[model samples]
Target: MKYQQINKSLFETNRAKFTTKMKPHSLAVFNSNDIYPISADSTMPFEQHRDIFYLSGVDQEESILVLFPDCPKEKHREILFLKETNDHIAVWEGEKLTKEKAFETSGIKTVYWLQDLGKIMFEIMTQCDTVYINTNEHYRANVETETREDRFTKWLKNKYPAHAVAKSNPILQRLRSVKEPIEIDLIQKACDITEKGFRRILEFVKPGVWEYEIEAEFIHEFLRNRSKKFAYTPIVASGNNANVLHYVENNQQCKSGDLILLDVGAEYANYSSDMTRTIPVSGRFSERQKAVYNAVLKVKNEATKMLVPGTDWAQYHVEVGKLMTSELLNLKLLDKADVQNEDKEWPAYKKYFMHGTSHHMGLDTHDYGILTEPMQANMVFTVEPGIYIPDEGFGIRLEDDVVIQKSGEPNNLMKDIPIEVDEIESIMNG
Candidate 1:
């Protein structure tokens, strides 16, 4: 991992929180993600499953974490199974985590090789009455691939059919949504890295620069800052391309007068920061562009304030829609008649600003959170409001990650990053 080792206390706390919610005599298991294949012998980069990383801080493939607080044998209560490492394997690949190293990485003392998983699991399965299986239950998830966790779940169920099955998603969804102090710091580091990348591109951007060039600049800054990669697939849409909400074909030349919509962020130590900033290709927004940009910024600022404790996620968006509607009206994009006659299902504001204003942001870009529940303190959310105008030949989006506070407004993590038009223009021109 490019990022420094996280404090084991954070993982220790996370495991405690999870285990406290588990049913008595239940054991919860988390598996590391597989190194997916691109073709023969060539594979995609390995990304540890966020659940295992959250609970055990084990950031490697072919790893497992088992939490059994009620186990009769004290050593077997919390265990880690990792791929065995030796001198020969170290020469071929890099140094994999040894048993000692695993203990240091995760706070758990009982560590075993992956080869012994079946034997150990069989022993534990007999002792426990219930098995907790991890599953992807995020609202935004549309997974089609069978993950390593899924295979493990199937195997466990087949091997121990009599054991009561329980889902770990509900518990994880609640626990992971709220940030611990250490987790908040890690996310802040990611946001700080993103700010550097954004600032770097502000000076580099100009007429005739390709969108991909801007993407390259962000990655360069991120890697140098210990960020492994983007939090998600970056969107470097220039000009009309921004009208396509998820446009990622960053191949076009940025015209002199066109705007570039940059929906990008950096990931540090598996934590994600999501940010979207649209700026002028020529380092100066035109009169119309400035007006639209400020309007979107206004909506973002107002929406962020609504992310306080006890705020309902669905109602927050409705209120944000109202804010956007007012902005669209002021922009002359929507009239009184348009709003009055608009369908309740899809508001008139949808014509210009369609996507949701916010989503939970943390370990995953669209992190885990039960939207039906009220917002809580320390929960991180992204307030992103965009105005996509195909007729005007540009789109404007401004986003910031914020922590829900106990009182008043939420704290903006990207506060140090440039957002104002004058500030962005001054940095670019200076």
Candidate 2:
């Protein structure tokens, strides 16, 4: 891991909170993500399963964690199963966590090799009446691939047909939504790294530069600063390419008069920071570009203020629609009749500002949070508002990751990244 070691207290506290919600005499299991294969002799990078990493701070593959708070034997209450390391693995794969190192990384004192899982699980399943299975239930989840956790769930269910099964996703969704102070600090560090990348690009961007060049600059900055990689696939959309919401080809050249939308961020210690900023390829925005940019900036600022505690997620978007409507009318993108006859379901603002203004941002780019629930303090969200004018040959978007506060306005994590029209222009031309 390129990032520094996380304090095990966060994981200990997370496990305590999760165990309290489990049914009595129930045991919960979490598995690390698999190293997926692309083809023969090649595989994708290994990413630790967020749930297991959240609870145990174990950041390796082929690991499992078990929690049985009501177990009759104290030693079996919390256990970690890790792949045993040998001389061959030590020489080829560098290093694997030793039993002592596992204890230091995770609060659990009991550690066993992966080969002992069957016998130990058999003993524990006899003592527990219920089993909690970790499943992916994030609102945006569209997983088609079977995971290690899924396989374990199937094996456990087939082996113990009489045990009651429960879902761990619901409890995790709520708990992961609210940030612990340490989590906020890690996220801030990611945002700070993203700011450095953005500033570097500001000086590097110029007319005739390929979009991929700018993408290269960000990754270069991120790796040197200890970030493993981007939180998500980056978007370096130039010109009308910004109109495509998920544009990531990054193959086009930035023309002199075109607006390039950079939807990019850096990740540190598995925490994510999301940001989007549109800048002129020629180092200054034209009058028309400046108008749309300011409109998007205005909407982003007002939408951020609405992210206070107790705000409803769905209704918050509705209110943001109203703010965008007023800006659209002012921008002459919409007229009086367009506003009056707007559909309640779609709204007139959809013509200019189409996507949702905010989403939960953390370990995952689109982090875990129940939209049906009211907002709470320490929950982080991204306030991104944009006006995509494809017909005009350019699009503008400005986004910043923010933390909902108990009082006053939400805290902007990208506070130091240049956003103002003058500030961006000066930095680009300076």
Q: On residues 236-274, what C-alpha lDDT tens digit does candidate 1 reach at each position?
A: 999999999999889999999999999999999999999
Against the unseen true structure, what C-alpha lDDT does each candidate score? 0.94, 0.94
**How would you encode candidate 2's per-residue C-alpha lDDT over 1-430 as one tens digit per residue?**
9999999999999999999999999999999999999999899998999999999999999999999999999999999999998889989997899899899988889999999999999999999999999999988899999999999999999999999999999999999999999999999999999999999999999999999999999999999999999999999999989999999999999999999999999999999999999999999999989988998899899999899999999999988898988988898999999989989888889988889999998889999999999999999999999999989988888999999999989989899999999999999999
The pairs that clash in candidate 2 are none
What residue pairs are clashing in model 1?
A: none
Instruction: Find the 10 residues in a row with the least total lDDT in model 2.
Output: 344-353
TM-scores for every predicted model: 0.99, 0.99
For model 1 the TM-score comes to 0.99
